[model samples]
Target chain A: MARSRNHEQWTSPPPFTQEEYVDSRIYSDQDIFEEELEKIFKKSWIPVCHESELPEPYDFRTTTIAKEPIILTRAKDGKVRAFLNVCPHRGNMLERAPSGSFLDGSPSGNPRHITCMFHAWQFDMKGRCVYISRQEEGYQDRLKKSQMGLRELKCEVYFGGFVWVTLNDQIDMTVEEWSAGSLEVLKPSLDEEPLEVFHYHKAIIPCNYKLWHDTNCEFYHDYLHYHNRITGFNDAYFARKNTGFDNGHINVGSFEVQYDNYEGSHSREEISFPHLPPNHWYMIDMFPGVNFNLRGSSLRCDIMTPLGPNEVMIEFRGLGLKNDDAVTRRSRIDHHNSIWGPFGRNLHEDLLAVTGQGSAMNPRAENRQILHGRHENETIHDENGMRHFYEEWGRWMDRMPSNPDKPFVERTTATSATG
Target chain B: MSNADAVRDSIYRSCMYKDDMKWQEWLDLCDEDFQYSITAYSPEIRNDMIYLSGDREEMRGMMKMLPKHNTDHSPLKRHCSVYAVDLEDDGSMATAVSSVVVYQTQLDGINSHVDAGESKVFLVGRYFDKFRISDGVAKFVEREVKLDTRKLDKGSHYPI
Candidate 1:
């Protein structure tokens, strides 16, 4: 094979048509990234944190959605609620720490209230504004404490106690309806017992958030993981189907992993999750990018906070049964760390690949065609998961994936030059 | 040499061998029952996490398979400061505490022209180590790396 010259490279058409390829601009364009924050991220129900993270009545955790700071707090009545972290007085951020309990009093504020350190304003756990600095002295009649409540977002704890929050109050669907049954595959295992997070880490990678989600959506890149290749390349693995659901979610069917095939690794059957078959693995890739993966002994979840067109912050959590004994918890942690930990065998490899993609596809770099063209009856190696995700993305953005400058046109069939 | 001197020498050698990618030399300094682990505390979940851990035999097997994996081949240089070394009354064991900062020079096969030659601090952590000493020779029995830096960018295939 010979390399193409500049003119030939520019003029040659790919072996696949619009449905099978997407313009790289969607991953690197600044304006398109801003539009995605408005149309896709803010409007969708996102799993921000697990309910176990805020176990106590006054426990709170802070996070961001589409760059807007959000705080989740458990009220005195045993309910978890979400609100904009910004304060109503002077728009100061209410909470700065990642997580803590509001039961303790601060130097300038009372106990059991979310306090704004800026001007000594405070709100109750239920987002009711309870105090303002010198309330009766400063515009007493004009600004009543009752009307100064925090801007509360729609929050629901569901699907195995994950705290789901949506910025759009007009959103038509609940978290269950939005999932479209994509989470049903792991429901038996996850919902059977209360899970507690045992490991947590975050990586601010230089890549579009979707690229990380794409890695979770398909398994063709398993060759990059020598451990996975050795332990999971059997016929049963190849036959696992990639099933796409409505609203762009996809589920990869379960298959037993042969852990004994890899040297120094043993079967995790003895510590398998509740109701899940021994050594089996299941994955649920939620649309616009959150991944829930259960591999027999432990469950791992990846949540993305998109920073820009070329950067994303990914938070990874590993969880196990809340009532595990010391020995069982140790084994569960070992199993979880061996594969998905920050210094694990597989997580770094995926980060390396996506960062490489980010470097090549930086903003203002040349636009190129990225192929999602492989056709394998929607099996493990097929590209159907990404295809389905992009379809939903295009619908929300109202722009074609193949050419962002053009309007989106729905396609009913796969029409590739080679197929 | 004194027991503290021997333990310090062994700790320095471990850093040098790992930075140079001399896996065999590093393993040779480890005792037969050596255990290694990397740990960090996450404020997001208010929990301590064990990121990686293994025994001597497991480390040997993982080192043997490193060549076949897709890794960030950037070279790491560990800067270590041995703060203290305390020897047991019987002189059969020693414990050392050190602070370490690892710097990674970006040299990947996919030289993207943007980050190819830049060097950056990759990790900031403290090493809490235990050693077994016999005949003035110290060997690592346990090394627990507690990292203060949680955002490990692209992370390393090998231990810090």
Candidate 2:
């Protein structure tokens, strides 16, 4: 209802190039969301859980991949496995709790098979139903137990302590291969020593998940943090570079972000991760929902998920020294929590901005918003990252790729000033 | 209960809930010059750091103004169960220990609940008129809140 920020029509005929955006319809259409579920989330190796969360054998956690609930557990042999959290029969959720020790059964719960709570149908962790209770009375010769266990999902763990799961049956790309340039930014901290997650915080924001992803991907908005502005004035951290790869699914946007300065405020400084040969401050907004950022002594990973069109849940994890002394560990936690936690002055402000933007989008109260900036090719001021996201989104949504002669989808919601 | 025991009870009642935002009631259980802090033990650093440090008046000002400024997050409540009670020899201050669990409820736009964590505390272990004691009552001149869960799940505009 607040007055819409002044801007140009990005998708219209004053002649914005196809390189800028595909269309706004992608934001509202449910069919598009389904297509994305298949082409993107189903195929990409999405982060499921951190290794620290399941260190001991049988330690398990349940999370959702796209709309499907997934179970990630450390099997007795020490390998971590992921499977559909759904019970094979009647579709009851196998693991109701978020994080816990797997006690009722093996991570999947069927002795040599997985089981369904509804009918007591059991199956092994390998997705093969091994047994069924009341076999004679329920179905004299009718049901098949051999074919029913919790569905096994394609899963892999990266060197940096993150476990990823996917729905696709044959994705040849390894986690490192998928992450590409991102590994360069992560290797410094991850290489020196294994990283351990010291803190986990979740915030539920009222907005579509893309809004959060876009906010994370783009850097021009750093000027909105009133405190960061004063502290980061000298650093000029918002300066960014956008790079696109041949695979098209993965892209990297490197930008400088300020670390809290001597004045107790932050100024963007060009600080590079130890691994990247280029010593420029940077971040890589990984596609399909993950961001890796490095600032000073710490590293942060933002994992975002869509609860619905109007709700998003973001989880932030701060990584630190694996063998830090007691005193150093405490300091790391404090430093991490100060600017990253729920009360973090800067992030909390950014979240509010996105949620507020969501408020307007939810009601279809605004028409086409613009995305024009001076530095398109030059990373520092370019709006190209967004263009890249839309490019990839279009590919996954089955839309025509942005060729010089092709026309992209055109969707314009009726505009209104809610105020 | 002995005089020392009574004093310990009053201190626990007042100070234990300070992080929970029961400001006035918490202050009333403290002496006029009380020092209250919300600190955490960092295993990496192996030290105690103050996330929030305040006194009665400071808390009063914070409790009153925080909600007005905080634009993000849901509401929360903390429930604590006492586990240990230790009485000093002179009975000047009784040190009581207990575990606490904070449940956060998202209220502004979403309806949800999350538990922050279980914390441990030590209440002054006797009686002290100077520190806050009246026959069967005990008040705190100082109180400390240590939390295991450092990152507040939904950092409220208000205290714990």
Task: Name the best candidate (by lDDT).
Answer: 1
Models 1 onward score TM values of 0.97, 0.70
What is the C-alpha lDDT profile of model 2 across A134-205, one tens digit per residue? 776887777666555567888887847788888887998887787665566456656765677766656777
In model 1 chain A, the worst 10-residue window by lDDT is: A410-419
Q: What 10-residue stretch in candidate 1 chain B is worst by lDDT? A: B109-118
The candidates' DockQ values read 0.71, 0.17
Tell me how far the alpha carbon of residue A54 in candidate 2 is from the true structure, in angstroms, after superposition: 1.0
Local lDDT at A231 for model 1: 91
Candidate 2 recovers a fraction of native contacts equal to 0.17
Candidates' interface RMSDs, in order?
1.5, 6.5
